[model samples]
Target: MVPVDTLHDITARTFASDNYAGVHPEVLAALAAANGGHQRAYGADVYTARLQEVLQGHFGPTAVGYPVFNGTGANVLALQTMLPRWGAVICADTAHINTDENAAPERVGGIKLLTVPTADGKLTPELIDRQAHGFGDQHRAQPGVVSITQSTEVGTLYTPAEIAAITAHAHGLGLRVHVDGSRLANAAAALDLPMRAFTTDVGVDVISLGGTKNGALFGEIVVVLDPGATPGIEFQRKVDMQLASKMRFVSAQLLALFEGDLWLRSAQHANAMAARLSTGVAAIPGVRITQPTQANGVFAALPLGVADRLREQAAFFYDWNRATGEVRWMCAFDTTEQDVDEFIAAVARAI
Candidate 1:
């Protein structure tokens, strides 16, 4: 029999996105462990129940987690449950929901996104106020939630104090807060704080707890920190087609991440690699580090034609801003020091 590694080029690596990385070994082992038993379906299994306790441990006692297939599903379901039929969400213009999820929040979830342009991807209370107004006006789509992305799309982070201010201001206005925490672990690792520091304790009503980008095969959880914040989430999950009939498998993968310290270790490693990449490229002339290396992602502006030249070396990454020649490179839990060094050398040679 041929080795599985020969079927594909396992040596190929990319800075495109963490989603490109394979599953963690522990998570794969967990999946195998959960496979033999005839567990209950649709989240009634022991694994799902244990996932709840594990999540509550990190997100606080009031937190309730619903496992979903992907980040888009989790975000849409969370938003749908948090809003009324005419509800709108306030988010940064660069948010994944606003720009990347292909408008799933609007088209599928039936929620309107009121996007604000920010210098960085982080949104402050002042930014939220721009779209949080016109209450009791039938003409306007009422803003019921202020959604922000942690370790935002531009690779910038919002401190705990900043998150508290946003949540405080939003809640004071009879609005709830939702965090698109796809990179939540990265934020926690970079800030040297637990997940709860910037979430449950800071007044964030709900969060999309990410796993795929960390080390899982595929899964994310929509965690309701405030019990009353998102009603009908159970039904909303099914309504949005995010319900997994074989949910124990999903739950088991998530448990493998949070039940131990794998989540933090993976995120910390990814963040460290990004920091190394940022430092390496900053020394190259004409390469401008666009955003602060706050998490596992690094954004930079490359000299014209240099990006195309770099791509020729098979070091794949995304062009963030075509107009500005800005690009994004994401590091995964599996990104090695050697990978970063090789990419840096390639960039130097391309220049």
Candidate 2:
């Protein structure tokens, strides 16, 4: 193993993504608290048990939490549970699973993803119907699941009513609904709604409930909302290789996140910072805010060469659309007002 002293500096931070931020202090403390215990491995520990209770408190009494290592694994495993050998999922083209997962759903899970182009990374019933009609056709992969992202990739949100409408439509078409809730907390904070409002109560069959994006060091949970709709997820999780052997650490971190609204507090702070960043950047003459600043991300299209000049100053971010010069700036749990101010100033200077 590499020497710890040779690692990247712990003090370094960035706005490239929330994944760049370090662990939340409270989540770290919980990990330390769960470090030295002889607990059963693989989801049988006290912490994992308590996490179920905590998750149920948010998702409903029947909600079940299955902790996985990262968002990709959670999405893959959860989607697998909702499909069969010949099943396909309908999702927005901009979905993380479609754009980011590198085809793991098809490669690893043998599941096909039927994608639709969405304006703001959200899929409506009209969009769902575009791909939902090929059932019982042996030549075509059956559409069995509809997966949606909350607080979407373009930093837009799905109001609870919007999600409810999609879920209702999906079920009517014999499709079970899955939420790739990698940023569910931000959507909840933005809408000021309980998690269940857009999830269980809205007929979401399963959710890849995220933690790493919000504040945990690294973990996401597959919340089984309607167990009847999802069969054999326990086995699917193992087959996907997402089962954490030392699960208490993962469970403890999530438990701490939900202990007293720490999830909401962290998400709200990040969202606030993004709103501030968007407001400041919009004032710059050459920078155009591309999408609404709905959560903790800002999508902007800058004048040609402006993004490269900004990168020279070590302001980290990525180009969302290379052809259009659109960039994505993300905020994290620890992002501060000062950070936003400095970034806005840097953008002004670069432009």
Candidate 3:
């Protein structure tokens, strides 16, 4: 299978999302390497087996990986496995599953999502208590799980201790803990901590291990840490339509991420790029950096009409809060220092 390189314009890039970046060369190379062989279907392939082992090494021996198609699929499958028919999830109002997933969890998974407004997207035990009431109240959906995002949707990170506290609090309330780790790699990179420090060792029950946002072409996995806390995910994934029939490719991409320090290297580079972007743009007058630039995203409130003017130059960014004119700039593994410099200059000129 000769690799196809010219299928798309390689020069096309954007700061709209990490999703906009092309697959990492290493990840694509791994994908090409996994081709040309007749592997078993539906996750019965050798690559899938290898992925499980690789994930276990990072997450712990008790951890298991079930590669799925995308982040939404992983979240819905994981949250469903952690909940019952009348169960509900407690998360920050900014959670991707709550705001971005188009209600897939409620519509398809049949679980209610109880959201709490967060200043920086990180949930605490106090916030969880706000929605952690009414257990066994048949009329109200029970709060069964606390779903927290690592390097949360707003790109802020939770320290290992913060995660441990939240997990302990949730467990004491008889609710399992689920981490929507869509940017887990970024959090690990920013904190310079091992993945386990904030996950398995800290009492997290299940993880929606992300791959696409990091570097994989397209794949995410549901990693069960405390198996006793989650069951029937194997069937849950199938019922949710997240079970990839040709799962070897998905497994192969994920394996490439966890193969060596590829995940860390990519995430660190992205985070550094965001830091550089934040530093350069903050010096510009009228550009207020809103959220802490902790991970690979920089949130700022641009001067009136300045965002639109800058859009004319790059045309790829999100208005995080339209009412407040706050915008979000994302950096990816392939995002360069030159991109940051140009974007900062563009902002300065626009202002």
Candidate 4:
């Protein structure tokens, strides 16, 4: 097999997933500048502390940040701390934890997911209870955490109030709450609320706060919010191999993002691009809209010929598992209006 990077030279670009995007300018500059500085190793650097302080303002004093290498590692570290070996995490059927992470929570963390049926990839408290109850006995998997993904896998979002309800319900049942916040900034901006509204005040125990998808080259914070729930997350991250030795690099990226509200700007740009792409794609004949462009992605049910032709024209996208017969087009911090227009033109010609 040819290495993807070896064969691919940048000619034209299209929506695929936010992960495919490059680091934002600010984040890049921070990493480049941080290269010359020597700081404490293993996350005890000034940069890491500064980022945490900034996050303290965003998520309020109720939350604390721990820099991790990527979203999966962050999720695994956060969830592992919250759940027991016999516990389960409740999530939407199409959640990233279930579909994208290759079941690492099960294979790597020794936990199970109590998958709830999701139409738009947002899991509800009702759905959680449906799966959480029957297995209360030790004979079956005990639900220890109720997990949610913001700007969910299907490009939908839950209101802050909805999240609070879900969190309250889960906590009432003695289950902790975790957010696979790989797109959390997008969600927070869309909902027009402070991060703390959903993360701390709303009762989330831990969150995998995303950075790479929005702007950074690589970094996400597994924010430990409800510190009382699960202990030893610091130790858990170290042993799980998620900790970076020269942790200042990871921490610097976050500091750059949080300090100037760059996270919000990146998320807003991505969301706007997704909306732009959705509108353009919908205008093309034979293209059927699949979901609302709520965050940084759009799902469309295009004719087979249209999908195929778009691919032929240097366009890129994913075949979403929840789409049945549609393509999932995602926007990112680097996605421009030019990209959206070019992809729309391709779709029009193909159909």
Model 1: residue 303 alpha-carbon error in angstroms: 0.8
Where does the lowest 10-residue lDDT sum fall in candidate 4? 316-325
lDDT per residue, candidate 4, 1-351, as tens digits? 767887656545567788887778888899998999578899888888887888788877866888999899998888899987888888888888888899898889988888988888887777887887865586888888998988788889888789899988988898898888888999987887777877788888888998888888888988887768769888998888988989999988988888888989888898888888889878877888888888888988976555666687757777764335588888888888887887777778878
> Which residue pairs come into collision in candidate 1?
none
lDDT: worst 10-residue window of model 1: 4-13
Clashes found in each candidate (C-alpha, N, C closer than 3 A): 0, 0, 0, 0
Instruction: Give the better candidate number (1 or 4) by lDDT.
Output: 1
Which lDDT values do the candidates have, in the order given?
0.93, 0.91, 0.92, 0.84
Residue 158 in candidate 2, Cα distance off native in Å: 0.4
Which residue ranges in model 4 land beyond 4 Å of their true spot?
Answer: 1-11, 321-324
Q: After TM-score superposition, what is the CA distance of residue 87 in candidate 3 from its true location, in Å?
A: 0.4
TM-score against native, each model? 0.98, 0.97, 0.97, 0.95
Per-residue CA lDDT of candidate 1, range 192-278, in tens?
A: 999999999999999999999998988899999999988889988998889999999999999999999999999999999999999
lDDT of model number 1: 0.93
- The candidate with the higher lDDT, 2 or 3, is 3
- Model 3 over residues 203-314: C-alpha lDDT tens digits? 9999999999999999999999987876888988898888898899999999899979999999999999999999998998898999999999999998778778888876
Measured over all alpha carbons after superposition, the RMSD of each candidate to the real structure, in angstroms, is: 1.5, 1.7, 2.5, 2.4
